[model samples]
Target: MTFKANWEKADKQYFLSAEIIEEMVRRAYTPKKLSSWSVIAGGCANLNIKINFEGNKLPSILRVYLRDKKSAYHEQKLGTLLKGTIALPETNYIGDYKGYRFAITSFIPGIPLRDLLLSHETYDMDSILFKVGGLLAKIATCPISKDLVRIPANSNGNSGFIRMAVPV
Candidate 1:
């Protein structure tokens, strides 16, 4: 999704509120003391915040889905499947908060690939692409569980929402 479209479509209700943050922390079974919060920019499908809890050195990410629960469910399922295989943030919680679906996961450090590609002029693009290709290769080898629902096909071979590299 385009940055403008995603930003404009972002859910205003998902803005960081004391109550919501508290609830997210509680659901994640984290310490009550909140140290800091910062908006994490990049993703177009969700609003994210990196939250630091008191006495904990590592931060956690709160992702508020801008789409329907189905999108959240799809993400959660994919995360679960890729947990140990991929270097993904550990998912802590996924549930409805104030009528909006949200997920809390362990915070991962580093700039997003999109931002790096946009800002850097002389970076090693080949190396980065090779790494990403390796990661995708690993994901392709993973055995998908039978319980997980596959996305229905479309005329253009794209899923209803996100485009898939392989035919779903």
Candidate 2:
């Protein structure tokens, strides 16, 4: 019962009003109206929304940091550390709107990994899992300085956006 209540509250707290999304779109891209937007399923941590801009050159995702901004910083840092090493999208902007920390990232166009993994025998499961294990091991062994989690007052990374990262 308590878990249900807590989840219900999270549902409420994480909602994004159209006005807020409009502002996010304007700042991240041009001042164009949103063609459509939808909540991405699966994640239990942060909330990701897929938004369509009428004629955007590339699709984009809006990630709302739930739980805390520290997690947001961690994710952004991981994206930086793993770029080119993995298949994650590029982050365009990281900022706050009405107190919620958010990021705008280029959407990677592909089928979900889970679907691909389960859909066919064409994939080498063992090799894939081994590679994934190696990646996780690398992340686990990597030294995370206090700086990795420390929110810099005004820092930038390949940055098109200002620094408002939250400290871990």
Worst 10 contiguous positions by lDDT, candidate 2:
1-10
The candidate maximizing TM-score is 1
C-alpha lDDT score of every prediction, in listed order = 0.71, 0.69
- RMSD to the native, candidate 1? 8.6
lDDT of 1 by residue, 37-127 (tens): 8877766668888888888899888888777667766777787666656788876788887787888888889987777666637788899
lDDT of 2: 0.69
lDDT of 2 by residue, 1-168 (tens): 012322323453367788888787777777676788888865556788898888776668998887688776677876775554566887788888788888888898876555556464587768877988987775565445645542232444533222233354
Candidate 1 collision pairs: none
Question: Against the hidden reference, what TM-scores do the models get?
Answer: 0.73, 0.64
Residue 146, model 1: lDDT of 49
Q: Which regions of candidate 2 are displaced past 4 Å?
A: 1-13, 111-124, 137-143, 149-168
TM-score of 1: 0.73
